[model samples]
Target chain A: MSDLKIIKLVKNFVGMDRPAVNNVNLKINSGELVAFLGPSGCGKTTILKMITGLFAPDNGDIVLDNKSLLPIPTEKRGVVMVFQNYLLFPYMNVNENVGFALKMKGIDKNVIEKKVREMLDLVKLPDIGFRRPKQLSGGQQQRVALARALIASPRLLLLDEPLSNLDAHLRDEMRDLIVTIQKELNVTTIFVTHDQEEAVLLADKIALIFDGELQNYTSPKNYYEQPKNIKAAKFFGGVNFIKSKKINNEFISDIGKINYVGENINDLNDEINITVRPENIKLSKTNDFDHNSFKGNIKSIIFSGTHTRYKIIINNLELECSLQSLGIKNINQGDEIFVHLPKDKIWGMND
Target chain B: MGGERLKIILSLTPPLLIIITLFFGGIFYGFLQSLGYQPAIGKYDINFSAYYNVMFSERYSKLFWTGLGLNLWVSFASTFLAAVFALFGALAIRKTFFAKTVCNFIYSLNLPMPHLVVAVGMIFVFSQSGLLARFASQLGLINSPGDFPVLVRDKYGFGIILAYIWKEAAFFFIILMSVLQSLGENFEELAQSLGANRWQRFRYVILPLVMPNLFSASIIVFAFSFGAYEVPALLGVIYPQMLPVMAFEFFLNPDLNARSEGMALSIIIALIVMILVVFYFWLTQAKIRKD
Candidate 1:
């Protein structure tokens, strides 16, 4: 296990005024798998490369286990990265590829062979010691790359979109394998990806970066439920942003006024923006006439696999709603409906 | 279907007939002449006398043996040296854009320059009274041009080997650059992440991936250097001449019997090149199997 601290990291490329990685700071705890989640070109992969010493940071230090890694070369930094393409050396067979690092360190032949076999078994590929990389399938090659990376016992393991090249089914399997192996070894790992779902599924903590800046660093649930800004919120999924006014003690929107349920609502500007996730807006066939309930017509119904999404129109305002299709009757478009915006799930933010 | 098949066959017949008639016909006629069956001289009887005279005759044996040895040395040395220089040159300039342009221009500048021109350039640059010798004398490294070391037209064929390397290294550089560009930096980056340093990445990963291409390129350089006539003709000494130069000299003789001997020497050179090519393929295939 290793703790990593990235302090004020900056990297400026030529012919660009804006730095690729701007003054980014992160503290990764020991034995934690943190996912740097964002859209593409959000400086997530740049940060990973800087930590691995592939790209030099213009101004900052990466301290691993309280020692600065700037002075160490890439090979001596003990940071291993599994690239997006799973760059297994095409010329080497499975066992030789896995044993390459130990051989580089001048380990004994018998011991390296034993360790290679052990790593292969750990990756659940015990029978492919003699096969070339081309002979293996995508998932199998991924395992070989992972096995090769892990055999070195690196201080920090970095995976850069490790499953982006695999098919959907193989991506799931590779994700589970990586999570299990990370847990079993208790190795501190950083996974850089643009897929928010993958981050939410596998990361202990997700650091959301946007436009070369760190937006939020917290648990996956908090990243999804309590995004700090509108950009971070939209990255998780779709959200209905409402322009509201803080009148008296209530927040007034086109949908209606609701009691403020947030800690920073009082200190915020009179005009604010609030968001409610689509799934949180519940729908029913009959009106309960509650304060948060409003009569609306189902303008459209999109039948997805496991759930149905409805676009509801109430008082000339459109709102998105999602509900599970398992126990509900078939809700048709243009049907009269009632939407309940739960007071707890309606989140407010300052303009 | 029969008409379509006939059309395809007709489309291919011109090139195939040209190859079979012109190329193979010339090779067969040359082989027959080398075997001492020359219809031009009305010597229809086939004999091993020309090959024996070229290999072990009193008047020509010394030149023949030394020419064979020098041909092997010059071809092997130049090919190996050119490949090494080109590989290092390509690896060094592949990263930086400005360096790539400048280094690429300097290395590939010779690619279009003819080998005859480069051999002449070698004389102008490396001869005792050449530009380098004059510059060295002015710098006080030598007292005069006559004090400069012999390089061009030397007995050991160093000047010929140098000329070949100068011309062929560009060819090698072009081949290696394309290969290295296609390969990209991912493998080296991954190797570095796996705790292999710069030299290790090159030795274990880069060298193996590019070896087959480099080997094939070297074969072309070696074969061309062995069978070519102009460079050695311009830069080599009369004694201990290269095989092609010696064979051309035999052809220049007035005796018709000597032309058969020249054909035998040319055939021997071709056989050597073919054997080396087959051996190279076998070796590379064995390396692939081992991997």
Candidate 2:
């Protein structure tokens, strides 16, 4: 197991006005699985490549196990990257591909064969040694890539959107496989992904980045619930922002009025932004006069099988709400309903 | 559906008919003459006399056998050298944009040049009294032009091999560059991440991916060099000439009967090239089946 630290990393591509990656710093604990999460062109994969030594950083240092990795070549650094496409060597069969690193190290032929078999079995592919990569399904090829990366026992394993190419069903299976194998081996791992759910599901911590800068690095739960700013909040899922003014320690917005739930609000800011997740807002057919409750007409109803989403307008303020589909009656457009925005679930940001 | 099928066949028939009329037609005429059935000389009776004379008759056997050896030597050597050089050249220049452009332009500069012009170019540069010899004497590296080594028309056919390498290396370079461009650097990056060094990645990843194209390109170079006439004719030594040059000499003979021997030598060269091409095809197919 090894810990990795990135210090003020930056990369400026030629002919580009801005750096692809700019002044980012992160520290991952030993045996910790971290996910660099962001949207496309956010430099998440660029950070992974820099860590794996595929690309050089223009500034800053990457230290693995308290030693600087900038001076080491990729092969000697014991860092392996499983690409998004699972770029398996098409010329070699499964056994050869997995055993390639061992062969390069001049391991004994019998030892390589035995180790390769063990790796294949670990990836749940016991009898696929003779098959070429093209002959395998997408999931099988992903497993082969994982087996090959793990067989070398790399100090740090980097995965660049390894499941984005997989279909929905296979994505879950591969995700479980990767998480299980990563925990079983206890190797330090970092995976880059544009998917929020995958990052939340697989990573011990999620590091959110945007526009080549680190936004927040924290536990997945905290990172989702307590984002640093409006952009980070919107990236995780749907968020409803209530423009409110603080009056006599009570917040008043277009929806309704609610007393402050948290500690001392003795500051001088009159206007502020209060963010609540769509799922946090409860919807009901009848109003019980609850805290922060308002009556609204459904502007639109989106039926997404698992959950039903409603765009509701209350006093000219549009608020999105999602409710579980279980045992729910038919809800249509333009129906009057009450939206309860829990005070405890709402977060206030002053800028 | 019938009309579509007829239209496809009609579109294909003109080229197919021309191929049959020109290519196979010429081969058939050559074979007829090789079998000693030359109606031009009014020798109607067909026999293997010309082949026998070319292969074993006391008078011409030595020249025919020596020419065959020289043909094989120049073709195989030049093909191997040119392919190795081109592979390295393409690999070296593929990374950077400026280097790729400049190197590619220089590498392919000789591609459109005629084979005969290249052969004469080799003569101007490599002959003892040529440019290099004069430059060497003027630089005081040698006493006179006579002190320069004989590279053109030498006994070892060095000059002919050099000319073929200069011309054919460009063909191999173009094929290899296209292959390398399509392959990209993803596999190499993956291999490096898997703990493979530069040489290891090349051997295990890049070489195997490029081998099929390389082999196919080599077959073309080998076949062309083996049967090509002008280069060897201009640069070959007198004692052991290349087969095409020897056959051309046989055709230049005053006797009408000499045409059959020339046709027989030409047929022999064609048969050798056909056998090589078939062998390469079989080898590549077998590899595919194994995979």
Candidate 3:
């Protein structure tokens, strides 16, 4: 079992003022696919590199299966990283590239060949083994890279923005392939990406990092429904924030009072900002909910292909709400509407 | 299309003219002379006598064969050693910015120096009565300058090989540095992640990635050292003289008839370089295809 734990990992670049990765901690169970999600230069890839033993953490331990991996060399760490550019060895054919790790292990040639063929089939590129990496398309190269990494059967698989190089369609295809392979092999995997959709779609747990610190590490749903701070909420597309103050357990805002229900508000400061996802704010023509309902006027409506987004004005506060296009037929600009801010869906953060 | 084609041809005409007339024209004239054609000396007949004399005749065969051996030995040894030294040097410094900058400056310092100057430098530094020998004598490590080991003008062409290595390793280093810089550490990192140790990473990834460039560079170095005259002429011994030095000696003969043999030797040197380059290309291409 390759359960991995990173405790207070820190890395400070020489010239930078702040640490590139600072005080980040995470625990990933065996066979659990986790994503280190953040924007560019947010230390997501730095964390991945540290885990792969490419970069040593300044002050922490990376434990895999109850053993500290700090002293192990990169090759002996049994951690494989697929680089962002899919850096396949240009001199080797696809089969040779896939079998390179096994060859390094002094495995038998026939056995390597058979395993390489099986890996090729696993990545769904069985017929292209003899072709060189340059001969393959971007998606095919990505598959070859994946096949090469997985063939090593690494204790931990690290992918650095593997799908960021692919087109839209290939991204979806590779996403499914990664999930399938990660589950099939039961390897503890951590992939770094700035794409939140990819993180939510692939990872069993998402570690949202911002500016070298772990903001929140939880299931993907928690990032949307219960973000740790306004920054974490904003990163996951939480935009409708209501500036408020918690007085006697009631969130008193400009619009109205919102009853607290989701998490304990004792830790939150009196001055707080509560936010709800645009899609979570229920918009209706009539007041249906007994609590946290506000009457508002629809200021604007944008009809996208799948969803229609509406900007509603309530008590001089403009709030954005998105509804499925199918159910948003009657909604139009300048129409009065009653929007319900569900107590359970509203996430509060101290300013 | 016709206008564009004419414009391209017009642009290329000058260099093409110089290449065809001066370069190939010189080679053709040399080839005709090597075949014993000498209109200047009141002889217009073309024959294979000069080639036969250089290759098989009793008068010149021993010198020709030994000269060829020395030429091969010096060229192969210098080129191989230079390439190996440059490869290691480049790998050592490729990861460091300051070291790379300083080394690049120091390494390219010799590239512009003429081979004759390098040969003279080798003699001054490595010869029996030179600076190193005098220093060794002063240190009491050697009894006298005469006790110093012979390097310059030695029978083994040590000084000649040394001069070439000193100059050519810079060339190899520059080529290798640019290649390794462009390659970065991505492939090596990928190999490392795939469980390849240091030696395995170098053997499987770094070496192959740089092979094509290194192969082409080695070809240029090999062909150059094989045919170059200055270092070998200044530092080579008498009996097993390099082919270029021996060919120059033949050309210096006042009897103009011996010029044909000189031309034959020069043509033989060119032919050998061409054949070897083509053979090397074929061997590498076949290996690449098989791989």
Candidate 4:
């Protein structure tokens, strides 16, 4: 019941030429875990702060449960944010820190104690309640922070780079814990992260931002398969871009006539940029596709641990292609190969 | 490791030797004199008569007890008020960039001022027949300059406490500002997000986070105000004076035997400060253990 909507959000910082967050709009359903995915300084954290009422937006309306939250102060907004460093109160032990919200609400001591124990069990750290935050490891502190935030039963839980401070193993562990708790409570959550893999793996929907603007907001699969713009495609690791002109349902580029299978292909602008993921480009010994296949000489081959990367030159156009190492059997540098651009994979963008 | 340890000890030797010989040597000499050893008067003996005379003798005990009371009252009140004022001031200005810059400049201006100068300034501003008294008389608030209440050289040590608060608040403010700047607004923001209002945020997050620094600074302020002679001597009253002023009066006496009592009183002041500091640490440590 805690659906959140951000409409025409704009915030301008002093001394900056452009806004830090400009006219960003988003709708998040209740119980859905949304990720505000962007690079550093792209205003993802700003939007989170505005929602938490730490920063007031210059022009916007943030509505929670169909009620405007713009006039509410931060403490009354029913939104809690776990900071990047997990700012646990250094003076308090784990029990006091976790029970602080209830204590603030003037709840009874025994109730708070019981709830604190329950939260400790939920976070899987029942015996460490007497230790100070300084005594905990980084991952343990993160869990304590999560416990504290959840103990409040907030309407919206915002996490700012929750896994950025953890090692790879702890990151995976905390990711699972977060997903588990987020579902168990069914709280609407939005976490800001720059890591694309974390966003893709954890988010029900990813809101990609760039230069203080919403680049694209969609499901993870669509964000990768059908990026809305060239920047979104580039951010998702789409490296091979060909400047093409759309004429009569065919895209003419330096590589060849690119054919894409999608509705509204003819409705695109006259000039557009065509891009496909490197992994999506099929490289084979024989010309498998009839319309969108080309023979190219492999200029270089790099054998990574999981995949093999190849740089192929086709008609003065160098295209990067990656294939599974197990699938790449007889490919070597300086070999003639046939690269096929799948009709359903080629994406056309006007920007 | 041996060479590194030797280098560290060698580097520390100069300051250590200076402190041991000059500082501790002075205290040792003073302690001996307080125990009734006077080489200048050809009297070398160790006894407790000086301490007894200062604490129990009929002639000086009354003055000693009252002076001790005044000293304690002034030190504790001034130190606590100054720390509290500086903490609120720091918190108020920590969020604004321009205000913080301007307030920092203004606050630091008082830190370099001497206590004697501040005491004199206090007298001029607050004493009867001074600038404030004359101004009040002119403004028709009072009949004459004498109608203004006595502040400086008053029996209550208001003028002395005022001077100490004015000077020490700046010191506490500087320490608090550095701590608050380093802490930033993260803890307060976290508390706010947890549904704590303004007072709760200050009470829980801000107070505890700054407590250690404030406690240490308060200890230094308390110890200094208890022992310092300049401001109280300039602005204190005669009947019930601070310990340092009364001690200096004993040193000014012509009888050389009075120096023993003065040394004993000085030692008593130092011992009281040390005991109070230990007690403060014990109280805070007990609280920490409970937490």
RMSD (Cα, Å) for all candidates, in order, is 2.0, 2.7, 2.0, 2.3
Question: Best-fitting candidate, measured by lDDT?
Answer: 4
* TM-score against truth, every candidate: 0.96, 0.94, 0.96, 0.96
lDDT of each: 0.89, 0.89, 0.92, 0.93
Error of 2 at B7 (Å): 11
User: In model 3, what is chain B's TM-score?
Assistant: 0.93
Structure candidate 3, residue pairs in collision: none
Prediction-by-prediction clash tally? 0, 0, 0, 0
Per-residue lDDT of model 1, residues B102-209, tens digit only: 878987787889889999999999999899999999999999998999999999889998998889988999899999999999899888988998889889999998
True contacts kept of 2: 0.85
Q: Tens digit of lDDT per residue, candidate 3, span B57-136? A: 99999999999999999999999999999999999988888999998999879899999999999999999989999999
Local accuracy of candidate 4 as per-residue lDDT tens digits, A278-341: 8888988887778689899999988898998999999998899988898566988899999998
Docking class of 3: medium
Tell me the tens digit of each residue's lDDT in model 1 across A133-238. 9889999999999999999999899999988889999999989999999999999999999999999898999999988888889998875566677888888885
DockQ scores of the candidates: 0.73, 0.79, 0.73, 0.73
Q: What clash pairs does model 2 have?
A: none
Residue A38 of model 4 has an lDDT of 94
List ranges where model 1 is wrong by over 4 Å.
A263-269, A285-291, A329-332, B1-14, B285-291
Classified by CAPRI criteria, candidate 1 counts as medium
